[model samples]
Structure formats: C-alpha cells, structure tokens
Target: MHTELDFAFRRDGETVRSGGLVYATVSAEGRAAIALPARLVEMLGEVRSIRPSR
Candidate 1:
C-alpha cells in the first residue's frame, strides 16, 4: 500500500510530515512479510485510536 506524502507547518513554523510506502514480500520461511522505515515505525508508536465524527 502507498500513501500520499502529506505535511503541514506547525505553529512554530516547523514542518511535520508522515507518509511512506509499505512493501509486501515473502520471508525467508516463505511467509508474508512487511518492511518500512525505522522513522515510520517510531511514528506508529505514537498513533492513537480515533473515531470519525459526523
């Protein structure tokens, strides 16, 4: 899966962005595997569950 690069300037005028491509591949044992940037992994840790409001 791929996500479009999205970013915005913070109040402090610093840009914050998060977007990356997810790759699908087979593992050494013939199992499905995924890989991504370490920075993206770190960002994932900060993710929170959210509900869409109408």
Candidate 2:
C-alpha cells in the first residue's frame, strides 16, 4: 500500500509555515502581488475520524 503525504511543519507543537515562497512579479515588471487573508496555523495531532479517499 502506498500513500501520498502532504507534509506540514510542526515546531514545539505548532504548525509553522515552511515552504518555498514565490515572490510577486511587480507591476513595473507587468504584474501585481495578490493579497491573501491571514489565518491561524496550528497542529493538533491527527484526526481519528478521517479516512482515505476511495
């Protein structure tokens, strides 16, 4: 059996953003940066009620 894992960063018991950041292409360079809403990041272990997709 094989599973594709989606990994996240967990440090001292919290989920920290750990990924490559893509820099925005400036409008001067003919593009604009997107604004994203801030969100809370936390890692509270695994969910026992979850199942694999069929």
lDDT of 2 by residue, 1-54 (tens): 112224457799886754332222233454554432122112323423222454
Best by lDDT: 1
For all candidates in order, the CA lDDT equals 0.44, 0.37
Q: Pick the candidate with the highest TM-score.
A: 2
lDDT of 1 by residue, 1-54 (tens): 222233344556654543433334445686655455567656656544232322
Give residue 8's error in model 2 in angstroms.
1.0
* Per-residue lDDT of 4 in model 2: 26
Candidate 2 steric clashes: 0
Q: Tell me how candidate 2 scores on lDDT.
A: 0.37
